[model samples]
Target: MAGDSVRDDELAWLDATEQAELVRGGELTPSELAEAAIERIERTNGALNAVVTPLFEKAVAQAASAQLPAGPFRGVPMLLKDMVCHSAGDPLHGGMRVLRDHGWTEPEDSHLAARFRAAGFVFCGKTNMPELATSVTTEPLAHGATRNPWDPSRSPGGSSGGSAAAVAAGMTPVAHGNDMAGSIRVPASCCGLVGLKPTRARTSLGPGHGEYWGPVAHEHVLTRSVRDSAAVLDTIRGMAPGDPYTAPPPSRPYREEIGLDPGALRVGLRTAVPGAAGQPHQDCVAAVDEAARLLESLGHHVEPSAAAVLDSPAILEGFSAVFGTIVAWEVDRWSQRIGRRIDLGELEPMNARTAEVGRSAPATQWLSGLHTWQQWAREAAALWEQELDVLVTPTLATPPWQLGELAPTALAPAELAAAVGEKIAFTVPFNITGQPAISLPLHRNPDGLPIGVQFVAAYGREDVLIRLAAQLEQAAPWSMARPPVSA
Candidate 1:
């Protein structure tokens, strides 16, 4: 599996699209690509801690397999996010010390994993994340935090932080990640890459499941190129029989959508999300304004508008309840598997808090939260119809935070709420509404860290977001910008 090392000149930290092209054209074999990625991962991951659980041997075996997809990205190397999804023979710790023991995965593959293999990706193993993929920073108890490539002292944003960091540092062209609450987009913003949270159900999650909690998680990839994101989505988007619901399919392939000219769109601009409290940092605001100007220059109509508040104070309180419910369910499931009554003492502080919240919630309160979420979704959908092709906002209210700053144990519940509120002020609303949103790296801070401009489209309108991303990428190219840690 050895040959001439990837030439430095040929290593511009290419995205999945470029890697796929080279591999498909016979310029690079999967083994060579995997080797290059593994080399970079070994060289840098010690400092970054991005690839928390490496499956190098399995990846090598997979890469050496003769059978591979004939698609454009056949024979590419990719990494999986650490939480939720399971890969056969991979020790998935789920980013929690309590659950570090390997769990059983079916002999057969999950649909998503099957699709990845079919796309010719050599699975390079899992990346780090917050416990249960619950938080925005990858500081789980089992594996230490994944450091930001741009600034080692800062977080790369998580639960998909490792995926973002790996791609940003060129350990891989692109990596599979999930967004349950700005997970993908937050890391994309911090790491200066393209991350799209496709419409709910756009990508199937299982052969044995439906929607995850109905509001939050969505499957997608984080990449350097919009085309790469689209290509991955194209391969995975479809509904399995058990899916609760499938998002409307695009008329064309997602990859093709990326190149299609998005005609002048009526973009609604809102720096502040009403009732969604937080003061966006100057850098974050600047990123949004610059994106607006860029859009105007690209012939799109940018109109100022305040985001409509779909949920009031009463409904806003329901979010934590819903989250807690998820925590309790996972804890119970794990407890049963481990043959012990799981005590909150062994869990991370945040996990403990979530479990407490869940335990304290009355059945009536859980139902109320679900009702509020559904009502808000309806209201938000209606508002989108009245105005705006898409909503633009700061992907994050603040720039990247110092490493360990947002550790769940360090902050009190109020402080944690306030901090989370500030960091992802604009993103959670879309997650609640199940709308498609993307983070485009359009601005750089003085220190050269990437700042992302987020554009959110109406529910199930991923095509529109892809088209918009392509337009923005063309207008203000972030491809030329590379982090100092880039290979």
Candidate 2:
């Protein structure tokens, strides 16, 4: 049952946790599983171009030396997205050519990596991403665009697009992804997978800064099942030694949350435009309406509600200042290490533009943005306290776009932002507020592309969102749905 051919087809397609279980149960060995996954990557990665850098040799070596954790996911194979999170000895390109020929990882794993290993995941290698993961689509100058596994004609949503694409193409069951402004959820929406952004600090970000740009970026996973996402969260939840914010401990393991009855939650359903720059696509709106109706059928009280309107310019301006500063810092550190001048010349136009914007930003802009975000978070939290258990919106404002639609050369920073603004109308504010959110694959267009419905909860309320998502998963099973390429 476990062989090279099957690795390319069946084994590669199993969820990461299932592969680990197969290894733990003695149905297959970790070495065999690793080889099979390696084979699948060799066979399909060229077409999908999901994995930019290969680590099969190291993966096989690790498979031989490492012992599987006695957890639910014992010997599963997985990929780490390139932008954030690092493993010892793995080449980290950050999806940029300037960092192309570099190597050197810390002696210890990032908290995200450590937790994934604790969950029984073996890192086969790193996946692709946009340069610096600043863009919405996954086309980095360093690594060519990652195609959607479903059509190859459309994009797998950004930053985590390669990880999602890999999973969609059956190259791996699950992959590590980060979300600050929809990286994980966007790709999941594009590729038809379950993506969850746990509440800020639900998972640790350690061996670096105290927090990731004030919770705008959180690490998560993209998977095929809600249970898998829940299981990973259970393993990863908890603060490490240096977290700036620590979410309260879960009263029980999250695996139990998947099946627990989230009885009669007052769902705040709204298809209104986000305070962001643009409106969602028509199909995205219809998908939200359909999800609301389904929740009604499930006996949940679905009603319209709205939170305080955000100061759009202040939010963007503020977010940009902090975002640009992070980029500048990372670029400087890497440039010094690589012993080369990594000027804007080496970067894509968008990357260069963002760096320039950051450089030009006044210190006051960052301070003001921080204050604005804090004020908005407090105001939004109060509104949530009074009116809703969950806020429903389209995960993305538009369905997957054609492959080169958001190319760096083709679009300026403003144009790209505007283009992405229209599609991802609702994601960033949650990032700013540090709310827990999940993207459920609930609707499909006539062409069979999946659309995700996003459910967001108050800060530190991932348990509530997870429980609710589990209910929705059962009411409308998306597990059997496969992208066209896989089918």
Which of the numbered candidates is closest to the native, going by highest lDDT?
1
Clashes of each: 0, 2
Q: Tens-digit lDDT track for model 1 on 256-276?
A: 886788899998887764465
Q: Estimated TM-score per prediction?
A: 0.95, 0.94
RMSD of each: 2.0, 2.3
Task: Tell me the whole-model lDDT of each prediction, alpha carbons only.
Answer: 0.80, 0.79
Cα RMSD of predicted structure 1: 2.0
Clashing pairs in 2: 20-75, 397-423
lDDT of 1: 0.80
Structure candidate 1, residue pairs in collision: none
